[model samples]
Target: MPRHYVMCPPRHFAVDYAINPWMDPTVPVDPERAMRQWTELRDTYRRLGHQVEEVEPQPGLPDMVFAANSGTVVEGRVLGAKFATRERAAEAEHFRRWFLEHGFQDVTMPQETNEAEGDFAWTGRLLLAGTGFRTDPRAHAEAQEILGVPVISLRLVDPRYYHLDTALFVLSEADDEQPAQIAYYPDAFSPGSQRVLRRLFPDAVLADAADAECFGLNAVSDGRHVILPVEATALAEKVAARGYEPVFVDISELRKAGGGPKCCTMEIRK
Candidate 1:
């Protein structure tokens, strides 16, 4: 099925400060390369019949390129983001304003510190929320109430996979024809959360440390084609075995700031 997505061009993308484990100020980032890779990803989505929308990049918000953190939109009702870090706090209002200006009437900016889709993954049936790093656990309940969906809280144990998008992604949403499927790195979660995941998605694709480190789990799926980082070869093979067409795109420049395909793409389900 075709999906709706929002992406931001990496016009001002840079690793000016270290936020995540993947970011290093000393490491050079090629903004030109990042733009090329981002454009390719956007074009790929367009070629696959997906609707792609763009948010104008702000001058000072370099991390705005990772638009997935903007918010979670479902059935035209948007739960706006509240960034855990002061650096990204301004981005929330920009995204909120975009939604309102773009015909989204039911937009709710949450009071709790939540990085929106950075820690929330909707599976059609429910929301898989992550905490213990960026987002606060309290935001899970707030999202559940605002979005009118069940929110399952998962705690992250590793710093590298701080956001849920870094460690897991929904491969296919639950529908009348099929149950939701996912791909995730088990080691990123706590033992209890890992157990919960195993119970819920027994058939999920599990990524090893190697692929997870490559930010392979930071993928975007349109219920068929899975777009991921080209460096995650092993995970790509596994996804392919499960009947998904793995589309590779190199976002190595963006990866310097800890983002990949899913990080740049925000699915807007309406």
Candidate 2:
């Protein structure tokens, strides 16, 4: 397994909020809380024997686009992501420099509409792409062409959720003998999109729409490791039965801006 995942510390809403006006000023901005949450998140992964490397954050970018800060790692190559918004354009530069310093090669940048790293989802040979939020549809098509993988494009219905990760995550089996189980927010996808997903993975477990809104049905990592909000205990029980140990993190501050465990992480090179 490739080591090291990149993460940036939130600046306590001190940066310019022009990129995301939806951020409520009424929410108390506490750097200490932000630091504690970041540390807890990083430490959780570290406890699992993974190195958590911290990345320097750009001065004025929106925190919601943290998922777009870098591309991804594939067989030792670090692909750079092109940011769609002007606020995020500088992030790709940092991504390139970080990969080079770390001795990773084959850095390829997507050519279309500025790529958003979060748009790229790896499921075996199928690279599903979620478009219409920050990621453009054109980039999705180009990525499939370049990567030589079938790109399943899922349309984003809610801007608050932003990336597909906010609403969906794949929970693959630990061994080849077991079937792959996908956890996704049914409400997040359109009617046709839901049908497509069901056809693709007929055994996919449908996360309740209400639970999904609670960020309970998001990404569940490891065989028994799942990161979710503290409020999702009932949902946690359902997943626990599937052998997943739900790791609850208090994301109340982060949720004010509409994000949770899945939103905060970029599973690059996993």
Candidate 3:
């Protein structure tokens, strides 16, 4: 199992601002329901024998609960995030401070519009970063130099799959011995980027329109087990056929703010 850290904010995790297409401030989310759903996801990780850590949420930062965006952790060094929009700018400092106070001393903040793990994903071999949304492509070069690994930049054409985690799922963590696996939605990428994905990950599980629309690609995996949205039937069936146990969870409440399992769970790889 891959160890991950998650956050559970005390305040209502609602879509109070329109950052992505998934957010609709007009519709209010239930605090009790969101907390219950977040707990279920966290509990699922523990039940599967994986270590789950929590980052205490600061009041008024509703989007802080999506821990994956806080930053990308690789080789025990953290390249902290610098969110693209002002709405999430305050999150960078909070996440950096938490990591530092918890013994992560190598945290460095890049002066670029990067939302970290939300737009940058580790695929065992290298890092795949999503651009044209929250992250800037210029930061990709800096990330490659800092990560000491290849960083492939993929452009997202669709606004719904604004983050890389939403369009792609990296099945195995960097520590796993087995070859890495991936799944993605072709429509989420630009024509050139889509071709790159086809040539690179030809065997990746392809999500249908319905499943992609429901955020099926936002699932998280620990090589053998995958935790995904309960509504992603088509993708779940395909994942099961591929020998992965897909644990379906109801995160509809969090979906209101445009996130799912992978968004909340940030795997630490060293």
All candidates: CA RMSD in angstroms? 0.7, 2.8, 1.5
Q: Write candidate 1's Cα lDDT for 1-270 as tens digits.
A: 789999999899998988889989898888999999999999999999999999999998999999999899988789999998888889988898899899999999998999888899999898999999999999999999999999999999999999999999999999999899999999999999999999999999999999999899999999899999988999999989999999999888899999999999998988
**lDDT of candidate 2 over 1-270, digit per residue (tens):** 323566667753333443443356565666667667766877877787666666676666546335533675544555578776785687778768876787765677877763444666666556667776777788777776565657798887866556777667766632357655667777787788788888887866667766776766545466457777888777677777777788888876666555566556655563
User: Which has the better TM-score: candidate 1, or candidate 2?
Assistant: 1
lDDT of each: 0.93, 0.65, 0.85
The candidate with the higher TM-score, 1 or 3, is: 1
Better of 2 and 3 by TM-score: 3
Candidates ranked by lDDT, best first? 1, 3, 2
Q: Which whole-number lDDT from 0 to 100 does residue 46 have in model 1?
A: 99
Report the lDDT tens digits of candidate 3 across residue range 150-222: 9889999888889988988987645556556788988999999989888877778888889888889999888
Q: What TM-score does structure 1 among the candidates reach?
A: 0.99
Q: Which whole-number lDDT from 0 to 100 does residue 19 have in model 2?
A: 43
TM-score of each: 0.99, 0.86, 0.96
**Model 1 regions lying over 4 Å from their true place:** none
Give the candidate order by descending TM-score.
1, 3, 2
